[model samples]
Target: MNLKLQQYINGKWVEANSGNTRTIINPFNQEVIASVPEGDESDAKAAIAAAREAFDNGEWASTPATERGAIVRKIAEFIERDKEELAHLESLDTGKTVEESRGDMDDIAGVFRYFAELADKDGGELIDSPVPNSISKVVREPVGVCGQITPWNYPLLQASWKLAPALATGNTLIIKPSEITPLTHIKVFELMEEAGVPAGVANLVLGAGDTIGAELSSNTDVDLISFTGGIVTGKKIMQAASVNVKKLALELGGKNPNVIFADADFDIAVDQALNGVFFHAGQICSAGTRLIVEESIHDKFVNALVERVKKFKLGSGFNEDTQMGPLISAEHLAKVEKYVEAGVQEGATVAVGGKRPEDPELQKGFFYLPTIFTDCTTDMSVVQDEGFGPIITVEKFRTEEEAVNLSNDSIYGLAGGVFTNDIAKAERCAAKMRMGTVWINEFNLYFPHAPWGGYKQSGIGRELGKLGMEEYTETKHIFQNLKPETLNWF
Candidate 1:
């Protein structure tokens, strides 16, 4: 694949002002795939200026809502047309299986199509007028320039979450995809441009968060900042976005919990538990890394998980039989290692995997064995911290109340799952869990129609659904007097 080696700024593909580049590596084999421009604050500033100018000039904001929707829908069509290529790029860049990347491409297209259909659904609402001979209505308008920062875990998928809504609502945006995994994002930008998006309406800046991302957050010209990443970086962005009091939407990583009751279908619960954390090698923001198992079945459940994990085929994402791929990079692998060591220090017993695999075939890549810690407490750092790896900390719970409490015992409340055969008990637990999304008898399932976000430090605003589109718009209460009957009182 021929990489687009420049940044998309101000309606033109251009190089970084400093003329520097960063090597794009395929994490599975540590091979350099391409070199992309290493953008800085200046490149971000230029992109922001372009977006602001385009918004102020009404280049995109003035377009009819249905027209914008059509263009956005076209982007979805383009994604479909190029889904296979996009999936290949995504797999190569992020080290996720090609099959998983194909699924993401499908979901990404669905997200764009969802927002496209929703774009013109609500022009505004007519309000009942309280005053005589008066007209009152509430209309939604574009929020001007927006800055979107997406994470590496699902590069194009996360970008679609931000881009489709922003564009559908007539807002201009500068999207900064994770520098490590930008291949699919760049390709999607090409698709958007081909879909008839005006040049400055959507911009792409490639670089690290400290430079390019900082400008997007701190710049006063930006009206909104939507970021998906770690809590530490999310907090820093919140502080920086206060410069102009820009509207913020954040999806910080979560140490999500998966509570399995003893009464749940034994085989299904065990299967879903592994499905929750092992997908993408547990790099997901909503990964079910914390397992709260009922005490009665704790030992049995751990044994089942260990057996299945032992048989997982670890290899290249392109391999059809590979169950899981390597982590994104060596640095991330080390972080997971450190987390495992810390878990051991905190008195958590490593039930299955506590170190990298000794397989010589996997040595060239960053591979860690699927790990499970048995004697984990809620207070253990392994349970509290978002390890973002292929590790699960199993904590025992005696009662339903104890399970709920243990699941909610975290600084992050993005998402969690409850596995049970009892419908009433499942509803009860779902209602009690303090999370943005709770799954019953399932895990890691999401769609474009439903809203996604968190309860606490996980995030500030919702994405997807109608609320996602609303995030890119501002409400205006327009009141007009039909008849001139004003009292001349000062």
Candidate 2:
């Protein structure tokens, strides 16, 4: 695939100030696909300066909301026009199945369109005035320059969640895509330019998080910093953003629970359990890695899951028959291995897989066997921590309260799922779960219209829906008096 190998700043494609570059490898076969500029703090600073200048001085911020929405909608049209190529590049970069990547492209386009339609919908509101001959109103305005940092797991999809809203709301932004997976982001920036996004309204900086990401989070000129990644880095960004108290929107991820009640459709429950976690090799932030099952059907559900998991065909993302693909990198593969080892150490029994695949053909790529662990307790590290891999830790619960308790027993509360034939029971569990998103009789299903975020350490703020558009804006109240009367005593 042909890709532009430069940093996009102030509407121009340019190389890093330092002539350093990083080779991007296709995780499917470890083949070097392209080399992109390995930008540093200086590049980030330039991008930030450009965005700051654009928001503070340029016409983008002052442009009519309808015009901004039209640009955002045009970007979605461009995404649709190049969906196939974008899917292929996304698969090549992230080691996800091309089919999954295609679905993500659709969702990404939907996100842009959703924000575009929402742009002019919020024209603020008029409020009743306590004093006569006075008018009071509240309006939402752009938050100036924004900094967005997306992760490698879902590069372009995550970027759209930030980019669409930021642009639609007339905020200038410097987006730093994950170093390992920036191909699609580069393509999207090209499309954004094609959509007539003004110079410096959207900038792309490619580099490691320590340099590019650090500047985005710490730069005082930036009004908001949106991040989607691990908990450790999220906390650091939070601390750094405190320097200027920049508005933050973070999606740190979760060890989300998929609860199966005895009354649920056994076949469907088992099927969705695998679908929830195995999609994209279980790299999703809202992956249902923790299987909190009713004790009565626990063994039966585990057996069904193991049978299906064993039949999964793991291969190249481009292969139509491939059910799962490689992990993003060897480093990430090692992390998954360590988590599996930790699970075993904590006395969880590996029901199916716990080590790397022994297949010679798969050895060249970062492939791990789909693993399932039984006899897991809530206190197990595997059950509590975000594995971010294709591994499930099954924990049994005897009652409804116990199931809810087990599901809530984590520092993260991003998302959870409940499977039950009874609607009341499902609603009860969904209401009780502390997660930001709760699925009833489903899992890992999200769209552009709904708000996505977490309740606790899963991270701050919401990402989608009208609330998402609001994240890139600041609220202000205006009061005007037609007639003024001075007090006689003054």
Candidate 3:
């Protein structure tokens, strides 16, 4: 049986042009498990065309908001029904633990449910009119076709962040999942059609960023582009989308900060710090890789953290006991290794795990042990760059002012965390951090209704909450006559 994965386009599973295929390998076994139709710019353009037609003249856009929400709710129901099978495929493609994939499925389902309730609720307001006999009512309408590019870190979860709101607001979409992890998304679109999404409402393409991302951003027919990826790639997409002045929503990577105060709950802080960086092998864009700890407690925190990291299971993801999985690919693993070497060369001491695990069973997999580096400074590359791996850098600060200053030093202001028992101190630090999402007592705990995005180079616009749907819509004003006759003013 050839694990031939089909691309979902125009509500059908369409094969790519030339029929060239790409293999999907199991990262743990280094064995090919599936194959996908290798897509190109032409395929991407076709998806864009399909979405454009759907948003402009098809049934998807003209439908009422309440009806659209019903279709989205059905999509959610379909996903919940097939979640087990989808989660299994996602874990197979990305090398994440089955448990983590199940969690991602839960997030995906919740996103669609939230958007189902929110679609008709976010109605436009009626503005006060100053002119006589003139009444203006504001209207929010779809921005038309949206080109959404999702990363592989959490493929299904990221898609829901864009898909639910876009469809709910009557904006059609052409989504391009990272080719490295495209299986789960393939099945997702299969379910969308199964749930009765009209033809051309949602489409999928597979390819590297150069061919697919560039094509979608530059395509004049697309009204908006929503991307989630590294800052460099996000910048390139922004420049490309400027060709037609398309609306853009970028959820870029972060060099997030996690501050530990002397009065904090030490055990919880240590655990959060480890999880903030090492979970998913630290592949999360919002990884709290930079740790700013109070000088008085830095020593104790580092020791506890190092001990905790050592206990993490370093093996293949298929093993139920394994806690950490491999990096996305061999090249990424090498790049992460280079960063660790750079840290050691720059006078930072590796308090724990600077090299790949020596487990004979895990030799074939692209795995790295949970790593921690102490005596780090803001100027160092490890502190400045997003170490998108299981690596954490610890820096000590004498005062609250210094910690906040150092946390805000980087150009990234995506997300951050502050741990302090003192309410005043906690609020002070949280207010000073230049990020969009700030955690006071915890890190990475988020409600579905909260807005998420970044500041500065971290990217533009927001995702989730009401702001997310707004990103795919435009505002208009309507004037109605309540007076008997129009009064002419000179």
Candidate 4:
């Protein structure tokens, strides 16, 4: 089937600014699945203008919050009704398993529903005033226009995380999705139209990060800039937003650690560790790529992990037996391979899969074998940086203090996971970890009602919670006189 594509700006489907086009290749098959309108700076300007006008003058911002929420909920309904088609498009466009894409679809729908449910629930709170016969209250107002930049891993889901809350709170948005996987977002724009989001309220612009992304970050008309991607690009976005000092929310890269205590449930730890890094082909930002296992049980844990890793089926995302899909692109696959090579040369041991699948059918794809390396050191690049793929380098820790130190050693503090049966130990681990989100026994799980962001270089601000909606809002204090005036300091 031939795929149809267009850029959504001013709530209309339009061609690229210069009619330049690019073929979006499916990483799983290395096939040109679709042709997308290659956009640039001019398209970026058009989108920002539409969203700015809508927020500044259109009825969208002035509409009741409850009604605005109803529109978001309608978008959720559209997502549910079109899950199969969107999931397929996502798999084709992003090289994810159909199963993974379907899960992402559910996440997208849930995000919209959660934010929609919160639409009309807010009201002003009364407080005592310092002055004689006076009352005061506080109000939350939308922060004009928002510029949302999403990464390639979770296209539709990440977009919903930003778009739903911003819209639910009556803020218009301009979305710049990763150019590599723009198909799902195009589909999302269609659903927004079906949900009756007014023209100029939500707009989609496609282009390289250097051209359009920079403009979105620095656009004086944009009030908030929310982004999710790498630390390098996050830094670039930060520099751009500094031009206007716009409210910034970033969910950047993570070298999250998965701690396995000696007395803990080793089986569960192994499985969660695998899920943490291998899921999404390990393209996630918060992947538990650093496995900090305590000694005395490291050998047994590694053996069990190898057996489980071997049983994982490698194939197309369309197949039910495939446990993990390909990486996002060939360039990413090569980077992962180079990391594995470094792990070997730096004295780490590969305990399981390290090379790509040998099957000819999989040869054409950007596939990489899920790799597990033991005896990994803290200084090694594989252990230090974000692998951003299906590779884990295991390192052993002795004392509790050492474990904490090792986990917190990295520049990134996005997320960390501690697997322990003892409540005290888990709580202590949670307290010591410097990350924004500390998973007691879970990994890579998020809800729209919880704030999602990272500490340190992992990025700033938050997303996906009550706090997330507030990211696009500004608080205003109001004072009123209830009685005749009183004398104050002259």
Candidate 5:
């Protein structure tokens, strides 16, 4: 059965004002899964107005922190109850394996629960007054209405990172999920309403970035804009937000690197290296697509990686045996193909699995085999840019210094890793790595309790942990005068 999705604005499920809609296709089978409203500037304006009114009228902004936390916790409860359905919807929406989609659901629930627990624990700060007749204190308050734009890669997961913190901090929000993958996010809005979120406190607008997203960034009523997507869009959002001097939190792309040393445990490193790039078909922004190997083991490591890449199972997301699902869309599939073609033209060797799987059953879907390009240099397009697919580039480095230099050569500094047993060497490399999050032995292991973000062109601020909550708050100093005296000089 095909589902019809609508925008949620001012606590009501509604259709687009223009009566236009976009069909959502399942990347797994290229079939129509749902259709959502094609929102535009008018819908964004309505959502912005609703959020502003809710914040200005204290509908959510004036709620007691503990009460707000309780409401957020209730949302988490609803998520837990509907996790299975949500997981299936997410799998169908983005063409990820059900297992991975279930894992995203678990993480999403945990994010909400984490913010709920943290909401009331912080009570700002009190400072001793230097002035004899005054008391001074610092307090945190909501940043008013927040406009959030999430990506298609991990629709609801990225939205949770923005929505949970914004709501927990007593702020009203207007969220725009990716036009291509709004199903899971639409389901989440139902959960939020069921949790008793007040009318106009949270609104959803399903639309393209040019209209809804641009309006969100340029709207004066929105006190903050949090966006998660590619670098180009992130820069555009920043430029638009600058007009109003709104607070901005952006998480952009990364051409991350994974460094393997000669002294590293060969078998474990090989396993983790594969885990780094092949998960989610390497669509992750922080996936270690650039592999820096010690010259001594470069040949051996490339051989092992190629063998493993050749064996990856690709099929429909619903299939239990499918280790990796198709790319998000036909356009993304074409882009990945172009990158592989460029890699070959630039003199990189295709070690294994460099083209589409020759299976008739998978032809309808946007499927690409796990690809590895060996004998690569840092200047190669495949190594320098983010492919955002199941592709890896192997480069050889003799020393740790060279490895650090090679890893830091790119404009991105989102994430990197080192695989070695020597504690001191690992520490040195980790310290030298310019990325936001570095792993010594493991790859792609993240927790909700730790801060997640990047350096340089990667992003402007952090998300997750206590810092995530801080992104949605503003600081103000309150002063109390114990005694008032007229100025004699006047």
Candidate 6:
């Protein structure tokens, strides 16, 4: 589908109030793929006002849960119908391989479907009377207008995590996707409209984070704010949310650990380690960028990982054989390069790749090689900070206790992995790890049925599963007098 990129606000596609546009580039070829309206604070306020009006006056909030679920299911159907087009656009926007983009499309559809089926499963709950002839019950209600901010890495997938639950709960929301990757998001909004969503129920604003994001968090009309991005932005959003004391849900980046013990299946561990960080060029928030290995087999594991990294096919996303694509942009490529340089300066060995590939066809694109840093210490910046790029840091531990200590020594606790043949040890490590999600003998695997979030400074609240739908709702207690006269104490 050809896209004339514009913001979707009040159920209509419109230009930004700033009259400015930002060019969206295809990272694989350094070509301009599309241009979208560059919205500002004014545009954000306009969208928020529309959502407020809709929740307060429109039929959306009063709609039955079953009907809302049906609408959400219809939207999922539309996503399935346009899966190929959406996948192509996502790959072009984010510089991920076509296969990965197609997988994301499938997961995105599943998210909407999951929430749709869950909508009518329960309607709050009933409670017993505490006093004679009196009854009390707890019920869940929509949280009114929500302000949602999604990142660029998994544009539509992350948006689905927020959009589906908010809509299913009968709340009006305005979403501001990252300025660089807004194509798929805009397309999904079109689908929502076609699926019979009411006017102003789902709004989209396109712009930079400083303006659009700030307005969404600070707007008094917005009852909740959901953000997924870097730690700095998440902190700012939290402060901004204080303006109205709005509910906040954040999913920030992490320096996740992939722990491999001496007893682990070496071959599978190496493969899973590569899959965790190299996919999407290691831009994922929960990428296992840190590899904490048992000292007994650290050398062997690092050598095997380096060998595999050398054979990884890197090229344009359109190439069917390409295993990895370019970095998201020139700025991101530079950032990754800087991180590699820092690793070397901090006394870490550049075990595999430390520079960009020399292929002439890849020269024009923002490409970075799969990099590995061995002999890494916990004190090193590369091991401590989230590069958000295609780089992995290898750290060695003498004992299981040391490995657990090393994994939990970070400010991030988003996700982690434990690879060991011993199921008991895996379970023990999973329990000790401070992360929100831990994979035993696996890495980077997720489902719609499980909750995803982080501990410590990683972020606040959870997304997905039944807990996700609850994030968009508020609790209320209703009391009634079954057969009583007025209270004389009044």
TM-scores of the candidates are 0.99, 0.99, 0.97, 0.97, 0.98, 0.98
In order of listing, the candidates' clash counts read 0, 0, 0, 0, 0, 0
Better model by lDDT: candidate 1 vs candidate 2: 2
- On lDDT, who's better, 1 or 4? 1
Candidate 2: where are CA atoms >4 Å away?
Answer: none
lDDT, candidate 3, 382-428, per-residue tens: 99998789999999999989999989999999999999899999998
Worst 10 residues of 5 by lDDT: 1-10
Task: Please provide the root mean square deviation of candidate 3 (C-alpha atoms, Å).
Answer: 1.7
TM-score of 2: 0.99
lDDT of 2 by residue, 1-490 (tens): 6667789999999999999999999998899999999999999999999998999895998899999999999999999999999999999998899999999999999999999999889888999999899999999999999999999999999999999999999999999999999999999998999999999889999999999899889989999999999999999999999999999999999999999999999999999999999998889899999998998998989999999999999999999999999999999999999999999998999999888888888988999999999999888899999999999999888888989988888899999999999999999999999999999988988898899999889999999987888999999999999899897995
Q: Summarize candidate 1's per-residue lDDT along 1-490 as a digit string, tens digits.
A: 8757678887688999999999999988899999999999999999999898898898688898899999999999999999999999999998999999999999999999999999899968888998888989999999999999999989999999999999999999999999999888889888888899997899999999999999999999999999999999999999999989999999997999999999999999999999999999999999999999999999999999999999999999999999999999999999999999999998999988889889888898989999999888887899999999999999999998998999889989999999998999999999999999999999999999899999899999999999888898999999999897759898
- List candidate 4 stretches off by more than 4 Å: 1-4, 482-490
Assess candidate 5 and give its TM-score to the true structure: 0.98
What tens digits encode model 5's per-residue C-alpha lDDT throughout 1-490? 3333789999899999999999999997888988789999999999999999999998677788899999899988888898889999999999999999989989999999999999998898989988788889999999999999999998989999998999999999999998999998889888898899998999999999999999999999999999999999999999999998999999998999999999999999999999998877888988999999999999999999888877888987778998999999999999999999999999999988889999999999999999989989988999998899999899999988999999999999999999999989999999999989999999988877998999999998888999989999999999998897777995
Residues forming the 10-long window of minimal summed lDDT in candidate 2: 1-10
Error of 6 at 204 (Å): 0.7
Better model by TM-score: candidate 2 vs candidate 3: 2
lDDT on C-alpha atoms for all candidate structures: 0.93, 0.93, 0.88, 0.88, 0.91, 0.93
Tell me the spans in candidate 3 whose CA falls farther than 4 Å from its real position: 1-4, 482-490
Model 1 lDDT at residue 50: 89
lDDT of 2 at 299: 90
Per-residue lDDT over 317-367 for candidate 4, one digit per residue giving the tens place of the 0 to 100 score? 888878888888989888989988888899989998889989888988888
